[model samples]
Target: MAEKKSSALFVCLGNICRSPIAEAVFTHYVKEQNLSEKWIIDSAATADYHTGKSPDRRAIKCMKRHDIPMSHKARPIIAEDFKNFDYIFGMDENNIRDLKRLAPKNSTAKIELLGDYDPEGPCIIRDPYYDDGDEGFEEVYQQCKRCCQAFLNKVS
Candidate 1:
């Protein structure tokens, strides 16, 4: 018998900050558990503001500080993603709203806030793109780490 594969997509406003952090955190957790083969993880944006761009430099730095490797190009959420992913997780209310608006009528993905899985934190992943310092990026990384761990525990 073979293990079943599950897929998740993380989303945010621009795909260069919060969403990519969540995606990377979750991927790291999965790899650590040796379950990477059983999961398909990715991230996207509700807007195309940074389409094809790398995640924010601050976000990359934060991930590096945590020793988690990340590599992703920004991309807008597409209708097909709604059907392909088993779960579609948004960083905040606005991301959820946009996902809901873009999801196809027949989409099978379970759309919800990524923070909903965080047992010890708020149910909203804040964006750090406009923050004055790296603190915001660090905060985002911490939140994503907790949320991703909890989410993995639930699904695995």
Candidate 2:
């Protein structure tokens, strides 16, 4: 019989920055390993702000610089996401609190801070939206890359 797919949902306050980067990096890594089909990956926001927007342009540029090809429209987390995804990763403490507050009683997803997976990095993927420049985006990208690698290593 075919096995069930492992699904992940990356989340932040805006969905246009940190979460998207994490989604893109994780997606790129899985694809590189030819394991994309075994997983369902996506990103979302904890709130409605920028709900229908594209990821922040700085985030796009950061991905481009790394040649990761990020392309995701911003979206807020839906009630169903709690049930659909196997893992729901928040970018920071606020995101984690929000996710837990919104999750249904029967939610089966393992909700945790994505940075918790980072072996050698900080346990918070700070928002880069209000930062001075694209430099913050790069930092976020690096954090996501490290966390993604560590999470995947633990899971796989």
In lDDT terms, which candidate is top? 2
Query: What is the C-alpha local distance difference test score of each model?
Result: 0.93, 0.94
Error of 2 at 58 (Å): 0.4
Q: Model 1: what TM-score?
A: 0.97
Per-residue lDDT, model 1, residue 28, is: 94
Q: What is the TM-score of each candidate against the true structure?
A: 0.97, 0.98
lDDT of 1 by residue, 25-138 (tens): 999999999998999999999999999999999999999999999999999999999999999999999999989999999999999998988888699888888898999999
Compose the digit string of candidate 2's lDDT tens values, residues 1-156.
999999999999989999999999999999988998899999999998997899998999999999998889989899999999999999999999999999999899999999998888799999999998999999999999999998998898
Q: With candidate 2 superimposed using the best TM-score fit, by how many Å does residue 62's alpha carbon deviate from the native? A: 0.4
Q: What C-alpha lDDT does candidate 2 achieve relative to the native structure?
A: 0.94
